[model samples]
Target: MILAFVLLFTASGLQASKAASCLSQQQIREAIDKKQIKHLAAIKAAVRKVVRGDVVRADVCNGNSGLVYELTILSRTGTVTRAIVDARTGSVLSKGF
Candidate 1:
């Protein structure tokens, strides 16, 4: 049980580290203008395939997995969900609150 707790804490730390390196809004806009990342609409559509909610915010991030779009979504009942999708392929990597 202690080992499991340590593992979970370590995993969370790694995820935080990746998120800490995400691009700023200005950089994201530049990437969009240069067509370096997939359109936000496409990224949303991809997340919708596996999750249900309305997107609140989306941003380009360099996650440990790859270049991704991190989105915050609000459900009908007000539950919030966060999703990460591959910026290039629009493939969802993870989704949860």
Candidate 2:
């Protein structure tokens, strides 16, 4: 049981690290150049409609439909929200509070 607990802890840590890993600006630019993703500005604009807040973090990633931008927003109420925008069309795909 102790060994199982240790393995579970290690696995969770690895998953956390992987989720925390995000693409750098240079990598994002490269993806745009290659037509793999859209510009960050467009993604931000798309997300703005769903929530009123400052963007705390933005990440370019792949989704089931294709490339997407995951935006973390801090709202006026001190609440954090997550928004997913389609990189290709600059449309909001989803939002979570």
Candidate 3:
């Protein structure tokens, strides 16, 4: 029983880590730089307005249509904003302040 519990916990941790590793800072920046995912202009504009100590979390979200680029801006003051961009056209799909 103890061995089974340990295995289960280890497997769960590995799965979590695998998902986290899928989106890295460097990879997300590269995606933006290469324009592989859309909404570069809007994302850049939003980033510029972000206050100091703020950071952006980006991911390739798989929605009903397919994969889309989603960026979540987290400000130092705890303000949060979400933006979804088109993967193919780089257009702004949605934005919320």
- Report the number of the highest-TM-score candidate: 2
Tens-place lDDT per residue, model 3, 8-58, is 999999868757645565665777688665454555565445433233666
Task: For model 1, give the 10-residue run with minimal summed lDDT.
Answer: 58-67
Instruction: Estimate the TM-score of every prediction.
Output: 0.70, 0.72, 0.43
lDDT-based ranking: 1, 2, 3
| lDDT for each residue of candidate 1 in 1-97, tens digit (9 for 90 to 100) | 9999999999999878866888877887788788888888888888888988899988787777667898999999999999989898888888887
Prediction 3 global C-alpha lDDT: 0.63
Question: What is the TM-score of candidate 2?
Answer: 0.72
RMSD from true fold, candidate 1 = 4.7
Instruction: Give each model's whole-structure lDDT.
Output: 0.85, 0.81, 0.63
User: Which of the two, 1 or 3, has more TM-score?
Assistant: 1
What's the lDDT for residue 39 in model 1? 81
Please report the TM-score between candidate 3 and the true structure: 0.43
Using TM-score, rank the candidates from best to worst.
2, 1, 3
Q: Who is ahead in lDDT, 1 or 3?
A: 1
In angstroms, how far off is 17's CA in candidate 1? 7.3
Local lDDT at 75 for model 1: 92
Poorest stretch of ten by lDDT in candidate 3? 46-55
